[model samples]
Target: MSRDEHRHIPTLKRELAEGKITRRDFLRYSSLLGLSAAAAYKFAGDITGVKFIPTARADMPKGGTLRVSMRCPTIADPHIFQWVYDSNITRQVVEYLTLTGHDNVTRPGLLEGWEASDDLMTWTLRVRPELKWHSGRDFVAEDVAWNLNRVLDPNTGSSVLGLMKGYMMNDAGDGLWDANAIEVVDGKTVQLNIKVPQIAVPEHLFHYPLPMIDPDENGVFGVGSNGNGAFELVEYVQNGKATLVARDDYYGDGPYLDRIEFVDLGDDPSATLSALSSGQVQGSYEGTIAQIDIYRGMPGVSVHEATTAKTGVARGQVDQAPFDDPRVRRAMRVAIDPPRCLELAHANSGAPGEHHHVCPVHPDYAVLPAIQRDPEAAMALLAEAGHPDGIDVEIACKGDPPWELAAVQTMVEQWKEANIRVNINLLPSADFWDVWDKVPFGFTSWTHRPLGFMVLGLAYRSGVPWNESHYANPEFDAVLTQAEGTLDLEARRELIRQLEVIMQEDGPITQPLWRSVYSAWSDKVVNFAHHPTSYIFGNTLGLNA
Candidate 1:
């Protein structure tokens, strides 16, 4: 019955009883803990076990530099920070907001808690009282309302505006969600009038592009401007290095480390990989399985892999020329063996991917079967599509001994057996997404996000900002919309399952492998991940040697 502050806050009275404190002291403790006298007695037992981590704890000694290595170059803007943190990692060091826990449940990080209307649209947010902003002003609901208003503002070019287009009192696209638009009744209570269920709201607070910019500073965004998180942005040298200092007044207790540094290596992934083994850098993110295995032998490094979402969207283009034909797409799907790809492609660094639009780790995901390799079926389809010998096409690939290249090589080797000619054009990734998202045919990397049905709406759904493949599925879109409105957990899962089936039936991007992503770091670094999208860097890593 260990108590988290989250539980203790709710059952203050019961916890007091368990602690054996006097009723008069219970009344006093109630006020000290910000609970009513009645609630203090009611939840006294729970309070007894509440773990209070005050910043001044003698055991919480903190002052050390954390070093982080990034696989990509420092970029200006990622545009789509809502689910995929498209912004530079240095910016992540400076921001804070409500977010999903590691287990993917709604968590109260920046905000104490929030409430949704019965309709699910239009939420009432309760900001954390007494929290301090980096600028030293007491944080209040105004920041939340202002940030949401910016996302709703059309001029901000916020990708969130598209996902939640209609829920705002004023349609942002047509210019209703404005800077001064949100109702800030006082300071602590702000009402967000969204037309959609407030599921993705937490995601909107993380990564780049979706940051909580200060309304006081116009065009004031990026690393230097934010300071509400556990870390503070200290330095950023584009495509080279970025650094951070701990935020003394962060809502989270502490970073445990004093500083975090990021080094960017563009076009030199091998050199970056070498640094981890040599101990020149504490950790390197988004390394291939081969490199990760190599680092495993190094004295003080740990490797972690996270399940990723593999959508046909933007990975490889399936809407043009040979790929445009659904039969061609089906043949491509049948051409490679998922088991072999999973085995050879990533070398068991990550989980064997299940068939779903999202990752298996995603909350409310449904279980499904993997597709078998049917080269005969693929050959038959290729012949039916006017080529007894397979059609020749080039693929663009990047990562893990170049898994994209390996998948292409496998497809080329397999398609040749079916009389198909395949050529893989290895594209150098100096920020691959910049060009990959626009490419007609290529395989790129991506991480799974927990926004549920929005996965389809963003990549597979029509008219999306990052729809790498031009796919049009009315039924899929309709089902996704239904899922968005369905609050029942299992019902949403079933809706997503239907959408997954739809993707399987109509894949615009041929999946050669469900990849296992890996990241390795020095023992000094803690709490880092190898994301599917390869975006964690700068602030997420805490230096604690």
Candidate 2:
């Protein structure tokens, strides 16, 4: 085995023994490190005393339509998708270069495998051979290169740019990515020379918004569904429905369902619940805690739940008045109790957050002292910030999702005691998206990401598009850069601790809890479960015979 391979084995084995990773995850990750699957399975079995067996294709009886109730999407450009709903529609037709499974282990998807340089600054990706696009053209190295450049282009307005800019772009300060950064080495090989050493390159490739698209499509998706995915889009209607049929010549394993349909039940959770209860659709995309309780007792329904880092943030744009003062930001953090918010909004189904973005699920997460709510201290801080008569502010959020609105309501009541008068501005789900990031004080729901750095880079980094709070701190950014490049777990954890401290002390957002997400399906559906990231993997689902 290679020196790097030897270094990884002990960590993988320790994680397996601690129940942090599954045997399948060990095997997949080991294989990427040049270990044979047989050897990896034996190594894992010896440690756990349990052999791992993969499910065979014959076990999945195929050929049925899976109709799921979800919000229909409007965005068709894969490079610039902003919402998970939009990705839900396009992911069926397009594929990603890597796939982060339910176990949070990233494995090759379109690529056969990848290798990183000793310093982790360069990555060499081996594209899988003979893969064909939905249009019957060959999938090649240039396709990958093209997609990367498209996302790196500032004019594209891709959400992925926020995540990749710091590591992959030029330091020329022109916001232009280095043209030579991504190179098509050969027909089946592509290489990336990044500006910084990033450890989460594989995971970032599977970010919901960064799906691999057909180079021939010219940056627009769903026009021809010209993808290399397991399914091809048959019909798509904005705010209505999208239908997809399986590709018989798909490169991957069973797309067990012959057809998959995503039906729009509107933004109301009640509408989706009604559709699910009445059998209008076989499954619902995601359920609120209240809806999950109802689905649990309903006959012929099966609920799948996963604890995730998914959570909502109540934030004030630091560039705006009142919020610009660190005193006011600190006051907001202590004004409300996270445990109480979790209880009122989620029925105490989730763990309280530590007022920072990092979650316990992340590998490099650093546990910090919990901040206690002190309304009196909050009032004092507000008074010190020149708000002696109390400050009146508005919190804006979408009416749908239910949880965001519920949490905001609880926060509003809590802030009342801190002499902070908060007005609730509940907009329709569609309209909320238009102004979600622009609202001075707003509540927004963030989906699950495998790495803490991924979300922090996208949402909190200075000058990025999704910096909801418009928060900028040179010290925090410097620490984050060191953490992102640190490969040693313990060393990374120390750097993460510093970042967490900075966030707790001066961050503009109050993250109350990490959620336990749920989804429900009828008994007729097979092999379908809730994904931690709330991704709909229609390709792996089937109908019971």
Candidate 3:
């Protein structure tokens, strides 16, 4: 190769490694410079490697009253509801276009199957013709299109809209609904014109935030239990309880339970755990590590653990003082002992937090070097950053879940070794989320997403609404965009590794642990499977009776 070409190769590799461009973009740009795809892919592979596989689960028996401690947080509105328990309730009444399993494989959920173009920009989904909604209306491609529009509706402010950006648009120039963004070619076929190339379209199709519902006569989505799920909403009492009855005409897989009841515990873990132990409820929708330990010793109760997207993250407002400097961020990361924090907080039930929030159980986990606790190094960095007398910062958090409070307490002690003094400010869960964006330093519990790209786009990528740290990096964004566009798994994995490294070095969030969320079930409850998504699969569960 010529000297000029050799010089450009490093830049191209860096772009691909950092996710500044997708494989397709790289190949297109490189061909002009006379580079081959084989050569380019080899260079990318040498940058990263795969080392983990997500554990998988199998089918369980179906039929029983699956009583859960958590209650319905919403009126089952797929677009507005944001909690896992809410999704667990809504999923039974409405099915997704795809089914993402514990293995992280996307299968046909509401749709028979789906296909995408080579560019990954266009997608075609085939709906099952024989399916019928709970309203006895035929399930069609338009229903799928309607739900996508619901999420894209700007006024509604759907949380998952970040994942569908570029692909979904208000093409009509009138309102949030757009016919062209999602086109119904026929009764059974729907085509999606994505804003950008997204190889994980099928996997994201099943995301709870993008719930597919049969539109009411007014064209509203998820208004009155109009879904094609295995179970039909029998009755819903907002914030109190929700009851669903199994549907005989259900088109998809098992909603094994005959009936499912969700009783709201009002964010009271004590009440929820008490109900589970006393047989008042068959299971608890969410169980912390402390709760699981208590249940493990209880007779006839089983604890199911799954690697979740749920993580305890320490976010710093990088736009503010101290954290505005990257050295301060790195200093805080190295000063805190993640392993000991995990031990103190969760009895080591979770893995130490890596540079990024992606869980170790994820298949796409790019094994970056572990961040070890180094007080001397941390102190040195702080000293160099002009904090010779050490630094004092106040952090906000909710004291529930027990572990979160314990984590903050332990972290304060660990950081003291580096002369960092932390002041703890505890708030209610509702209060914390309300003013989370305003807090300069705080601990917040983030729920799970099926893909690493999903969370990264929502919280880390610059300019996104949920980018808590307001972190912006052109190269990192480029890498993530390219990874989304490329179908090559290995290349995507390599891009994720680079993304993790970037976040590790300068990102504002100091993630200490990726906690394994659990569901505790009574012995009478049979075929209760654990899902990493943290949503309960009520349709597949069965009971001894």
Candidate 4:
């Protein structure tokens, strides 16, 4: 070995783990290689296995704070504490007791394992032994009980409650949509019972808004009162951002990174793209599919696109005079071109989804022929509906990105040839949802559900009562209900396929396009993935040098 900048011999010696390479041998070797005491110690440590470290010649460089950029400048307070989303970045900063695979399959997370009876009615949970909350409190079954009760409390007004209500045990279908009981036998064992046996119960436990909360009034975020995880929300600014530090005292696995910052970029995809390009943030969750090239083609970045895109669509009330007739809704549905939405409106990220709410990427999304744009058919329907001249209507939408404006503009232009005119009145985000309390004709992105069957709720069921477009039919709703518990995968899918056919023929919602997945990150991060809807591999991700 020559006394210079290289440690080729020691590197070889370390790799050999060969026979005795004493301190003198190491010292002599260091001297021959001109290694300083610090470098010598590093070499000796590597040789002795005292502080051995592996070479990282990959994207996964070690030990650095990852800068993240995302849309939704500020996620709601409750969402930050809970696993709900005002943003995708929320999952990276928080965790749930359970997680699902990309295929919407279920797996255990916080809880070690769970079991259910033959009928799948009663669920017994086994908590991991070393679980601890972010605040250093031992995570016990009490936290689980508290979390279940809190979400069910009408006052909390969690969106998940209504969604999870389908599992609670009920007599004669009475309490089917309410919490039956959650019994905590001890600090680690929990017995959860629903109204009846429902296979989906365990899967729904990790539903958004079910994040365990601290029961004490000491008012700590995810403290002893709640449960435990790797990253704890140490600080948060409403509509701004949040910062989380590693809980070195974490009970299970860990967040190898020292800290995580969720920098909110609001909902403007354009602004989000700017932040990613300008290096304001290393990665983001809020950017839309439109800006993929800007981030991926950059000097140091990699992009993994989702195979199936998420849907963004508009819906309307049918009980009213204008849309009461199926012909009226069909005319509007048949006239609009589906592909144009992704190009002109959504920035070409995703393809046009069928009239069905389920994405084509979804396992069970119906594969029936798409509804083609038929101006002739649209005109014929309008004439039958007593609107030979044309029908005019208004729509309500979040107006963020001015969705209503663009949607209405496009609809008006397209429908003009078919004798229908749409007046788009854009409303501010808050105002849009607020006005929905008094109005019903509007557009909305349906919630992502666990299965393709679940997506059926978007049009078949009243959806969320608050947003139902008065588009209900007893027959459609019954088929959806029957499909919910059939358990037979093939049967459920066939039923769903039939439902999509029925929707295209008579249902009121006009589902347009399924948007693609979009995210950006700096090379300083590793193990980043964009999820279908509920992102997994969140807390488990790490940062690199």
By TM-score, is 1 or 3 better?
3
TM-score of each: 0.78, 0.94, 0.81, 0.77
Error of 2 at 265 (Å): 0.7
Cα lDDT tens digits, model 3, 119-176, are: 6666788888798887788888888877777666666656556566534544332243
Question: Between the candidate structures 3 and 4, which one is better when assessed by lDDT?
Answer: 3
**CA lDDT, every prediction?**
0.58, 0.81, 0.73, 0.59
- Could you give candidate 1's per-residue lDDT for residues 1-545 as a string of tens digits? 01222222334345445554334334332322233323443444344554323223345435777666763354343333533423446445545455433433334556665555446565555677877777888778787666766665566655565455434434214665444346786788776665555445445444245555566665454557645667666666766787767766655645577776677666556877778777778876666655666767878888776666543222346567887777777777666665566666667544553334566655557777777778889899988988776787766655434555655666567666655566666666653545776767776555555555655555665544556676776787667767766644567789888987777767675555555567787777655655555555343445665
lDDT-sorted candidate list, best first? 2, 3, 4, 1
Q: How many residue-pair clashes does candidate 2 contain?
A: 0
Model 4: CA > 4 A from native: 1-62, 72-94, 153-156, 169-187, 195-197, 217-227, 319-321, 346-349, 398-408, 433-438, 458-460, 463-471, 534-538
List the candidate numbers ranked by TM-score, top first. 2, 3, 1, 4
Q: Write the per-residue lDDT of candidate 2 for residues 370-473, one digit (tens) a residue.
A: 99999999999998999998899998988787878889998899899999899999999888888988999999888888777778888887766678788988
- Candidate 1's displacement at residue 306, Å, is 4.0
In lDDT terms, which candidate is top? Answer: 2
